[model samples]
Target chain A: MNPILKRLGFRPDDRVVIIHADDLGMCQATIPAVAELFDAGLVSSAATMVPCAWFPAVAAYARATPSADIGVHATLTSEWDAYRWGPLSTRDPASGLLDDEGYFHRTTPAVQERARPDAVAAELHDQINRALAHGIDVTHLDSHMGSAFAPHFLPAYLAAAAHARVPPLVPRLSEERMRAVGMPEEMIAFARNIVPQLEAQGVVMVDHLIGMPLDRHEDRVETAKQLLGSLAPGLTYVIIHPAIDTPELRAIAGDWRARVADYQAFCSAELRAWVQDQGIHVIGWRPIRDVLRGA
Target chain B: MNPILKRLGFRPDDRVVIIHADDLGMCQATIPAVAELFDAGLVSSAATMVPCAWFPAVAAYARATPSADIGVHATLTSEWDAYRWGPLSTRDPASGLLDDEGYFHRTTPAVQERARPDAVAAELHDQINRALAHGIDVTHLDSHMGSAFAPHFLPAYLAAAAHARVPPLVPRLSEERMRAVGMPEEMIAFARNIVPQLEAQGVVMVDHLIGMPLDRHEDRVETAKQLLGSLAPGLTYVIIHPAIDTPELRAIAGDWRARVADYQAFCSAELRAWVQDQGIHVIGWRPIRDVLRGA
Candidate 1:
């Protein structure tokens, strides 16, 4: 175990990390923010969404730097009114997965109702192959919009992750573990039922995951402090989405105010100072991979 | 349950669909893919990685077309070697998460050893703010490199995710669950156990997840077939990183071979035909959101 794990109260590093960035090949602002976050000490790893057109640019960057920690942002859905892509598996009109244009239908339900596992897997493989073709040294995998997790799609999801040998960012918990971690009963029962099924398929899982702070501008500092004070000694993950607001964004976004607020919080200096004051050890995905592998 | 869910399940009229594009701001390839996908009816929703350098290009596109399903790609790590970025958090030497050039360390371990949760959370929020400030809609939130799931940083991850009220793509499971899913017993769990916590916090977790296909070129087809044959019942998410290779990419990527292979697989007509023959369905995120929210 690493020395830091012990200090955090783990027995010779009982903890793990999965420092991840969302939407790798998503948009212009995201590319730099994710790259910069990774470049700086704020994050440890990031992933790329294949279907998005910007993926090549991201892939080129990844190719240029082979050692960068990258993962496949497995994409099953194409989002954006004006911009979208079809499944790597071309659509069949009969499947209804695609619209009149033959591209993917604009939502998960459409895919769920019309998409087939065969199509999903094909597109999935195609996306990965595309990344490899572009020279990306992907280390892990994740979902683009959680479409794979919707009802009736779990089986294919596990098979794909196992086939890839790439560690999945999400974990499926069991009832006992959920209880130990203080989860609600319904969740525990739900976990108990699902855990065994997921394990049977060779899927990996995690103990706990956390989300990042989402406070308004006024509450940013206090929220950060409170969250820091509540830190526990266990492998946990927090998720956040930050972006620099632009007029173009406001027009497209249903709620741009919240997004702007999040960006401000990310750029805040006070939060950084507070983290130092609290001595909370921040980490990312590489350690988590190591810890998991070591275990 | 949302009305969309009923239609998706074949118990109602009108098949609901959500064709979401996985990546938008990732790179030049992704941008075109998304645009083409949308144009071709292949996808409907998309997001952006605000921190990425190529964001300007994506932002320009979003500005011109306000209907895209654009969201913030919350960034945390800079995994690439030559390409890296720093956290929005105030630069701190103690964090030790910085790279040689003072950007976030390229590897996850380096960031884990030194990053501060408070700082991490702050930076995450700041990135969101940046997205909003730019005119990005940021419909939802997700991780770039799984930065939010870092072992020591999970608490901060949760705090940030919860604060945002946006859904995060967490798929945690317990060790025992993996056993049920056929995963090796010795493997440490990371994502499963956190399901309850995420659910309790009202954070959205994908039901299932998958990864990109790796290793052999010919094996890609069989892998896709296997993936299709064994899909489980749920919203299964499969991740992939696809990009068009170029001289620029060759200069950057150490694993140029893999990138090339991935691209080949993605563009293969055989795979697309196989998917069509298999009757697989495809969808996107917006439809899923509608189903979940009953919108």
Candidate 2:
């Protein structure tokens, strides 16, 4: 029996998974696609980019639909070439959360190299606060582009989640696996120390995290099916970025085809039937939020 | 005697001017600059770009300061190279509100050639409605890059303002002057006929519209002083784009120096004293809104 499943009151053999969408408020295309997935009950959870231009639309949707399992996608990077957003806390040149162009750094490496820990902490809190202020009953917190997963920012991220009383999307990876994924030795050391502490404090950490290859653009439905078949027992988190095919999406994302494919794959009856046949016990962050809140 | 002055209970000879800031919510730079101007009572009114990424900050400011004279800057163009925004109503490629890159057309000419009239109307209404939804108590509407002032869009623009019961920033330009500024014959003909109708409906139009030369990067204070010295007795509208000097502003605007100069010019004690000496009666859009609302 997986201890997380036991904690969540699941049976010994239960295979719980969270089919989650990423970047729900990134653009107009994302909103409709996420809404469709939620309405169809295909995706169990999603997160929003608090700093994006289309975020107000997400806030409005959250206000109208209180049951949607939405979280704050703690954004620390603005990667698009023609569309950019900056830190909500401060735009000072010395803030260290900003690149030379005054937007968030475009890549995780740039963020890891340049972002000051205090600024990172402040920005993460601001993102969560802004989401809450906009009436989102935020269920969890997750990092965009994995920027907050860097060792220097991990403490701030955890503190922010603790402050907000929401479970963070933390995966229980071994130190070796973390290193294989390019996590620094500092992060591995910190994770080794903090994982158990968080688990002791009743934060739910997934047994595994899975995502599709970013370069795979074709046969996404087949890819998704294969991924589902390969899922192991215990709790797992699957992250998918799905967006409707629109000019705006194409303009902002070079991986528009892959995103569109994800949207189609998740929304298709074929995939839904496959998941049911696989007997995956789909769950959302609500239970984790409840646990964190001592409900 | 200026009929607008009589309507507003001002003497005919009073040199009423609106020292207005354009692009209030366009970025962080604009917000603080506009706030400082408003706090110091240098600028009389400012308009917000509802589609811009930083617009929620403006809404927050408006909510905190109920007396702030804020209006919707009906945005139909996203002109910057690295920072762009799209129409609020739709992101459909075929909607004709988007350019090849899926943003609002970068220039007024591009918008005029590409945007559908119905799409333009819907987007303008959506922008205003979005601002109102954000609790703006919107006082007026004006065109960004004058996209809404084009002949084909004029009817929709006026209709949006009428629907919202807020005055649209319409200037009383002579037919020859409009032609001189490259207004198409159709626009001149349309303005000639519609201006009278709008006035008869109690819509106030400024007698003269003045903006500093776009190319003037230096001596902005001197230029502003000279412009103030040349003000006519009839109601004149002075438009300024003021932004704090920051890396973000520099990245988004080619005329950042001029914008910063405008901020400095307006915030200067010298300029404030000069305006006082000139006895220019500064006004904002709130009174116009009241009149349009039959208050």
Instruction: State the C-alpha RMSD over the true interface residues for candidate 1, after superposing those residues.
Output: 16.7
Mind listing the fnat for each candidate?
A: 0.00, 0.05
Per-model C-alpha RMSD: 25.6, 18.2
**TM-scores for all candidates?**
0.44, 0.55
* Candidate 2: residue B205 lDDT (0-100): 81
- DockQ of each candidate relative to the true complex: 0.01, 0.04
Which number leads on lDDT? Answer: 2
Worst 10 residues of 2 chain A by lDDT: A86-95
TM-score of chain A considered alone, across all candidate predictions: 0.74, 0.95
**Tens-place lDDT digits, model 1, residues A52-163:** 5457568777866665677788887665543345544343455345654334566666677677776676666766776776787666667765666544566666556556
Tens digits of per-residue lDDT for model 2 on A23-104?
9887667888998999878799999998776676787888999989999999999887645676766555566877764467
